[model samples]
Target: MKVYLRQAAMAAGLLATAGLAGCVSAGSVQDPMSQPATLVPETKTGVVLDQLPPPARKLDVAVYSFPDLTGQNKPGENFAEFSRAVTQGGSAILIDVLTKAGGGRWFDVVERNELQALLQERQIIQNTRTAALGDQAPGLPPLRFAGISLQGGIVGYDSNETTGGLGARYLGIGGGTQYRHDIVTVALRAVSIQTGRVIASVTTTKTLYSVAVSGGAFHFVAVDKLLEIESGFTRNHPPTLAVREAIQLAVHALILEGVQNGSWSFADKKAGDAFIRSLETEGRAVIPVDALEPIAAAKPVNPPS
Candidate 1:
């Protein structure tokens, strides 16, 4: 498998910078549609009402953190830079997609800054160890979140060249070339934050092209010519286009999972899918979920006595 070691490193760096305390604003409130029509279970007859996991007392959607891809070896400058760029771009894409799909108020995509502030106010840094045991853990809080999802990764490409000589070096001449392309795969995962269990995960790989050239003194000329040819292709097929496409695809997959799991409605699923499609087509990145009127908040249910 092709590896995007640098992209992974960049993702980690951006996550650190974004932190976990940003406050996402609810610009407008949207109306909540009626409960989803029931689904019939395969094993039974009558309709099965769509049941939501209990409404979380507090819903916090964490900004995704990419897995460390720095490996034992240090990454070079180009890889590091690419990794960071992709991570930031991917994270922004996920945030915008989720907010639009969840209708903003239904789910809170915690701004990194806001989350960081909350942690600081509570005096809880993720890496800090505490003396409290189990129930007494230092950062323990009763609030419950509906879910958390993370998405991102590195992207890469490669290519090659060859040489051949006429039998007995009859005016000795040699030449050959080949090209291969592939994009680094990115992963997206969704989990039930309260339970600390994954609900869904998806990985996508895109293609990138790379070409190599080789020969003799003539090889220099061939190499220079190849560079010009490749540069033209690269300029037209930039990594940003690939990253953006991957992000949109990943978000759409997540939305489908949310609907199937009862975390989101058909309406929400439709809206979310449409919004992302629009983003892909037009260059418009923002979706105004807050512009709609607020849906009535679900009343809390008491736990069984």
Candidate 2:
């Protein structure tokens, strides 16, 4: 027993020492938020939007606001924290996603969230020209107007809607994995500015998954000596990402809905038909994980002249 005890202690000591090296090592990439950052969507809906073809003509769309309607806090071990369940800058995220859709081929979004600021800036520009060069100053371009208006906000945020774990133990040494699910819902609608009619509406939801893994060991090396060690890692999916995904899904739905009803069209007729056919097939709704070879094969190679 004493001999086995010494071995366990030595092994555990080695593992603990090795783990510490990660703390001081200079990694190839910096961890998230080590500096200023941007929101990136990584969901199936986002993937679909990226794969979809761009519209033949852009639509003028205005988003006045998309604030977080849910006032929930982050769940704590014993109590909730003050941190919000979703990002407060959801409007900005939505705009970014809209512009990025179809490789920046979706909508021409107007600036309406900060109307007063925009108006003030415009007034300053006009005043500056008049003050500097009298009446000969060049006139500023007119502000663009939206044909359709978008409305709604992040309607809901639910945390720990699902939670589970799996583990095993042998001779006081054990390992385990746990997972949790959170969801966010967003609602959006498009209304005609000229007729004041609601053209389309969509409600979409996204689920955030979190996973944690851990390993631990414990044993009695001697009658009076004992040893224990634990190591764990957790990866959390942000709720904001989920929100972005829901919005992307909604936009894709809107595009399909419009095209099907003749509300819009693609510049090329065959491109439109191919896109519609792809939408019908689930396989084409997203770009394949290894699509380079498949895409190359689909396109005929030109013979050398």
Candidate 3:
């Protein structure tokens, strides 16, 4: 009994020491337990979106819907809940992305997804004017027509695409880091309103990564008792940010393909580095390469014999 009591007391003392370490330490100005939200001058999307130049001519575009085709939910280790894996307001996010493409100079979007509500509001205004002044109130201007339609949805989501951990244990005292990766994919297409034909299509993907570094100790304090202690920090990439990045990449692809096919042209030539260098940063493709070689025009492999 005496030996067991001593072991219990020693474990308690070690835990108390750790608790004290977590408290305010020498020269510390703030509580160690609290952390503020990270502040940044600009969002990653804004920084990249701004790289595209304002277009010389904007196209009238309409969007009827952008739905989440991936019906997956947040994966749970214990019990699955009815929560979604991605944001429900995906259509709104897509709309904002369309507006920001080419720095708000690309698409003049018309609100057709809520066509009935818009019409009801317009009708109310028209009737109120008619009731107020008998007959002739120079009618409201006609609603603008769209020349193009943008459509698609979040098509795929994979959970735990990759997961790994590295750790070692000696006498039940150990530390390790574990990481997981998830992926999302989106597909977008533009259609010619007049012809009802698909004009351009593109797809993009974003990866979400999470990592945790943890150290823990477990020990037996008595014949029938055990003690355990653990501390760690985990970081997860925001899923919404992943969605935004995927959509942004799709938009970048659309603009470049359109320009290459002569669907539209940039107004300011000097300010179009962003559009010209799709998936590029600082004047080069974001692809990583160790070496490069310029190639001369290659001879035809073999003329069709």
Which tens-of-lDDT digit does each residue in 1-305 have in candidate 3?
99999999999999999998778675466756555667423456556665676655777888899888999888887998688888777778788888777568778889988899999999999998999886886578999988888899999989899999999879999999999999999999988877887777898889999999999999999989999999899999888888888887787777655654456655654345333445444453332221111101122121010
Q: Is candidate 1 or candidate 2 better by lDDT?
A: 2
- The root-mean-square deviation over C-alpha atoms between each candidate and the true structure, in angstroms, is 20.5, 10.2, 9.8
Q: Candidate 2's error at 285, in angstroms? A: 6.1
lDDT, candidate 2, at 170: 95
- TM match of model 2 to true structure: 0.77
lDDT of 2 by residue, 127-232 (tens): 9999999999999999999988888889988888999999999989999999999889998877888888777777878889999999999989999999999999
Better of 2 and 3 by TM-score: 2
Q: What's the count of clashing pairs in each model shown?
A: 22, 1, 0
Give each model a TM-score: 0.39, 0.77, 0.74
- What is candidate 3's TM-score against the reference? 0.74
* Model 1 C-alpha lDDT per residue in residues 6-48, reported as the tens digit of each score: 8888898888766632332233233233244573222100001
